[model samples]
Target chain A: MNRDPVETLLRQADWAAGPPSASRVDLADRVRRLARRRHRTQTAVRATAAAVVVIGVGLAVHSATLRHRLDDRTVALPPPPAASPSPEEVAQLRSQLAQLQKEANDLAARIRSMTAIQEQRERLARMERAVARLESGEEVRAQMERAAFTIVYQADRMDRELGLRESALRAYRQAIRLFPETPSAKVARDRLAEINTQGDRL
Target chain B: MVDMVNGPALALDGDPLPTEREDDGLVARLARGDQAAFDALVAAHQDRVSRLAYRLLGWSGDVDDVVQEVFLAAWKALPRFQGRSSVTTWLTRITINECRSLRRRWGRVLHREPAETGRVCSPAADSRMMNGETLGRVRRAVAALPVRHREVVVLHYLEQMPIGTVSDLLGVSANTVVVRLHRARAKLKNKLSDLMQE
Candidate 1:
């Protein structure tokens, strides 16, 4: 091909035509950020999984150790005294039974409290997932209103039980502001005012 | 022409590798994951990609999109590149592939219709040509050619790549490239005839 210098020159001129106004730096930064986030998420998931595995192993080992210790304790404990009708022995036996009963009751209460907390966390997680699926803004706002209502009701009930009316009233006022059409806020306000009046008299 | 048959070292003129100090700096820095090197690579190759896209799409809006995609695709593939060819060759091949893909979607609009309007024209070259004017003009002329013709013209003429190298890039025969160059030059002469007549 006979290369015409002028046409060749014009063709070369076209190569100098710059890229669009969009920043390559921004593009690179975006790529870097996404890469870093991917690394962090992967690391976090592995770390969490590893922690769970470690905790599970530790619990299993501890449970085995405790079972062995219980066996050892049963073996080491002295035999019960002969079944003789004695007043002092009966009294000591009753006291020991009472102590064991008390300990059992305390453990049961703690278990129930822990179970309730876990249930609440699971409920919140479910709500979060539901919120994620609700694409409609109105639906999300309605959910927010319901949450606010429930929070105000719970806070007021807690405050009454715990003797903290002012904080409860503030929560009720927030709920009213968030959803003015609700009746919970009206009843809370009336009750709070009554509490304030009583406090003033005191 | 250097004998390309022996090894890449002897294949100097159509090596597709940049010989400039800045390009050397870029390769070294890029190996180190330097952000500046990546940016520089985009900056350097963007125009070449865009020009190829404009020619392929015939001055369409898809040029910028294709150009950006080409660089992005190059970035992704850069890590895996085994250095079989030079970075310019690798980038140019990517740009050419991207342009062809766009061509397939757009279905080859050769003759500009009266209805088709408001294409983002290439940046107006400074009328006063400086040091790089010869190469620049050749690039512009190559960009104004049809997609198929422009590929060979760019690879062979401006880049000074051998017909065999152009063939590999386009997945066509060396004979096809020679023929395309012949036709492209004829078309270029016709297109630039008005300027020559003036």
Candidate 2:
């Protein structure tokens, strides 16, 4: 029978793939040991991964809370007083203002009193001059009285022209009392009687 | 030329071992930590991995160690079986890898245990055609082929893998597998020419 020599040769070698000599018991025991080791390793790895994930979540939550607290603190805090004055500074300014107000009031009172005293002093000096002129001589006294009555007549006339009836009446009476015999005094008495008649008519 | 004298090696090419659905089901059960499923898996593939390792390494002493390593690896990976190939093809890949690892441990040198065959036949010769002497000669001829060529012959002829499957297992093009098979056959032919005619 003719045959392909190589095919014949391969067929001859097929026994190399014969039934294995390894028993089922031996292989089973080895496979069992391998399975146990694999189980243990997988369990350890999973536990470690779960721990890592939990710790990561905890850290994230803690960080977020800390940030929120810091933000709240920032919002609650007052801003620095860059433009507005502080309480101490405000108190100092008010004290200075009060001191200035008191000084101003005192100065006004002083000026008013000084004005009254100056008026009194002027009246006293005028009386003293009148006395001095009366004591010098009768003729000089009459001349002085006439000069004073003339000045009074001029002021009364100006006062009457300027619509100061009361002032004019007072000036006229003063002239009559101080220089009763002078010519200006007679004129003053006539003007006074005329003003009195006019007042009575009103 | 279908010159099949032994039924088992040729039979594997025609007969399906387990379907993809069976593999998918097995993987699912194994993934769920099903101990019985793992046992069933080891029982099913142990013999095949053992035989393939024995042939590839050309040594019997190393076959059991290679087979156990293959199963231990399978028990771990069967749960994650991707269904890219059948469980049978996937297991065969593991068997080859383990065999290669063992050989590498010994610096890629395989000491052929004198061809021990009580079963198998040749077509051009008698049914029981010189089982010891002739088989030994063929085994030496195959082992003498280059590593790439030798694996194709062992897978395509002795292990009865489809060319495409052998190609996939070796991570090469089908054409490349075919080419290697051709070259391996030619070399074996040249080596066994005088013996086959005897």
> Where in model 2 is the C-alpha error above 4 Å?
A1-3, A16-18, A35-202, B1-16, B112-128
Candidate 1 runs further than 4 Å off: A1-25, A30-202, B1-36, B109-146, B156-168, B171-174, B186-198
Predicted candidate 2 versus true structure: per-residue lDDT over A1-202, tens digit per residue: 6765665556545533333453444466667675685576557556655755665566567557656755675567678644344577557756855665565566556556655665686578557755864786753754545454544544453354335555556667767776677776777878877777977999
In candidate 2, what are the lDDT values of residues B80-157, reduced to their tens digit?
776677677788889888777776788754655542422212232244334565556666666677878878877877
Error of 2 at B142 (Å): 1.6
- DockQ per candidate, 2 decimals: 0.04, 0.14
RMSD of each: 29.0, 67.5
**What is chain B's TM-score across the candidates, in the order shown?**
0.57, 0.79
* Cα error of candidate 2 at position A6, Å: 1.4
Candidate 2 Cα deviation (angstroms), residue B187: 1.6
Candidate 2: what lDDT? 0.63
Per-residue alpha-carbon lDDT of model 1 for A7-109, expressed as tens digits?
A: 4444324322322222222445544544554466557556655755665566567557756755675667667654343477557656855665565566556
